[model samples]
Target: MTALVEVVRSGFVESVHHGSLVVTTPDGAVRASIGDVHSPVYPRSSNKPLQALAMLRSGLEVADDDLALVCASHNGEPDHVERALALLERAGLTEDDLHCPPDRPRHEPAAEPRRAAMNCSGKHAGMLATCVAAGWPTADYTDPGHPLQRAIADTVSEMIGEPIAWTGVDGCGAPLLAYSLTGLARAFGRLAAGTGTPRRIADAMRAHPWLVAGTGREDTVLMEAVPGLLMKGGAEGVHAFALSDGTAVAFKIADGNARAREPILVETLRLLGETPKDEAREAVDRMAVGAGVVTGAGRDVGSLRVTGAVAEALGTGS
Candidate 1:
């Protein structure tokens, strides 16, 4: 790993975040890299878009906005929960069929925990819908040996152009597959530029960015601010996205610090000439101002900024 971002307080470097990052050209060739882009890592919820594509391939049918929710790591707001329940109702199922663990809304700490309010519930609902559509058993949809999971595994391997390096259980209790960051970037690039299946997933996400995340979220804010940009972030500091031109970026912060993610992503996009323009520019600027800043005594005192190897690889140093 290499120093991907640094925490600066009063002009002094207080700490550093080590990580790996890879940028791919429109055709999926590595344009720049830092740290171990080739190593396999569980991409967690970042894999939702790919998993949603797999469900679609298996005959899961839903409205575009619902499909966007299928690719979400949502904030579990009322709209998100309602859409999730609606998908289950349409499939002749209910929240009881959802396999993801019950949890409170990410955006509402005071709310009660419910399966439908779990961030991964939308995905679980989609999985059940696919099973219903395909005439597969829904009871064990989350099992690795289930038809839906096998299909998802195959889809992931095919899209990433790499075999699964490992299989593990995700926080949502679904089967998780691992692949290199380079392969992950390639998959997103394909989703950005390809037609048919990949295009459908990308279009749904771009059309309903709010469902994919929520108010004030980095994924929602950035995707809303940048036209044709598809972004997703996972647990453990993983983030990936692709531009309209098919250029893609993927990275993982070694220490799993979420605070460093946005600054690094914003800097990476800026370095690659993908900065938002016109009206959207102001939205992105506002979002950036809230990222990575440190506060003390209720005042701004420091910030986490992209620096070292990743910055240098992108033709900047800080």
Candidate 2:
């Protein structure tokens, strides 16, 4: 296990986060790693791009921005909802065809719940479009035995280079596939370097970072700051990213706090001798790490930071 992050309070060590991470080349060779990288884990929504590939294979077609939405876990801002609805319209479907439950927009915290505002709505819309294009049934498209799901399973198996060890329901009620962290890294490497569908998906993500996430969100902000990075984070502490040079990293935090992701991402890039641009660095800096200012009553009382092996890897000594 790797000591990935620490919570510091009033000059005392409070808690620590442990996890595993792996970096790979475009060819899927391991470049660097910490902790166990072969254990099967659910990557959650991080696998959206690959799912979009399955949809494409089923004859779903749309503009790049819409395609990007199909690969998004967006903030459900106005544009996101609009595009999702538009995708459904293209298929002669509607919000009623979506299986993802209603939810308030993540970007607009105060907004009311809406089916189209769910982060996974765009993905469901894509699946519906695929069903329409392939002459399949829309109502049960989320079923594991549905043709769409079978095709998705095949696509995931091919990309990860292994049969899935588990199948579970995702937060959005869609199938969730499990793969080893290294396998996830390898798939992301291919997305970054391969031609055809993989390249097209990556291009769409890079070209429309906002659709991929939203304004000021980590994924959108990071992609905007760094010209050619394709990044996506998943629920329960999973993150995957690839650089244009074909270097990729994937990790999971033992504790499900997403705050631990970016520090390791930046550190991994640094370890690979790739420095983020100044603006990108600043964006990452503003993110809430596991360790940082601890305040009570609006006054700074202490701080937290990365410590232990991962911190050492980041070249920040404890």
Candidate 3:
């Protein structure tokens, strides 16, 4: 097993997170692997871009900015909510049509929950819009057997180069699918290479980074600093990104701690022969544990760091 990160306090190892990471080139050659990359895992919201492809394939029509929102797990800032509501309106639907459970906004300086504040609202709106376009029944749109969902499954199958390994309901009540980390990396590579809908979605995300997450978010900050690099982080410690050069990386933090994500990603990008811009590097450092400060009782303490096999893989001293 690979221990991807280690938390240290007072110069002693505290705890460790085990996980898998896979990097692949444009031609699908394995560039690196830190653990059992073949194990199936739920990609969660990282799969949104692929899901948006299904909406496009089903004849859903919307502007590029709207398409980016559909591929977002937005922070529910004012713009995110407004765009989500507009999408529903465009489909001749309302928040009542959204089956996703409303949740409090993820934005800082938090706000109350509303249907438009749900992180998955944009995705749900996309599904509803696709249904409206295809004349599919609006009700039961989340059903696996629903035409829209079935199309999404097919699209996912094609992207991952395999049949569905498992299916479950996401937090938002929509179907979630599982795939290997390597498969996930390959899919992101295709997304970066963008044939059709992926290009539009990628362009929109790059153009409107705020809508993808929010101001000061890791994804937004990184995308802004690194042109042509696309990134998305899923719940439960899954994150994947691809660069214009066709390098892609995907990983899952075994303990599901998000703080480890940026450090691992930054190191992985370095190992892949790419260096982040200063601004992006600063954002990553802010997300990293050892590189950032650890506080206890409002006083500085020891910090977390990467250790174990992943250290060598990333060419960093443990």
Best by TM-score: 1
Worst 10 residues of 1 by lDDT: 283-292
The per-residue C-alpha lDDT of model 1 at residue 236 equals 96
Candidate 3 Cα lDDT to native: 0.83
Kindly list the per-residue Cα lDDT of model 1 for residues 1-318, writing each as its tens digit. Answer: 689788878778888889999999888899999989998999999999999999999999898999999999999999999999999999999898888888999878888889999999889999999999999999988899999999999999998888999999999999999999998999999998889988999999999999999987889988987788999999999999999889999999998888888887788788777767676776666445333377787787877777757667876664
TM-score of every candidate:
0.96, 0.93, 0.93
- lDDT-sorted candidate list, best first: 1, 2, 3
User: What are the lDDT figures for the candidates, one per model?
Assistant: 0.89, 0.84, 0.83
For 1-318, candidate 3 gives per-residue lDDT tens digits of 788887777777777888988888886667778988887899999999889989999999999888889988888888999999999998999998999987778755456667788888999999999999999999999999999999999998898777789999998999999989888888888888867777777778778877889876778877887778888899999999998866788999988888778767666655556666775676666565544456677765777676646657655644
Better of 1 and 2 by TM-score: 1
lDDT of 3 at 288: 58
lDDT minimum window of 10 residues, candidate 3: 285-294
Alpha-carbon runs more than 4 Å astray in model 3: 108-110, 279-281, 290-293, 314-318
lDDT tens per residue, model 2, 184-270: 888888888879998899999999999998986778877887778898889999999998877888999988887667666666655
Among these predicted structures, which one has the highest lDDT? 1
For all candidates, the clash counts are 0, 3, 0
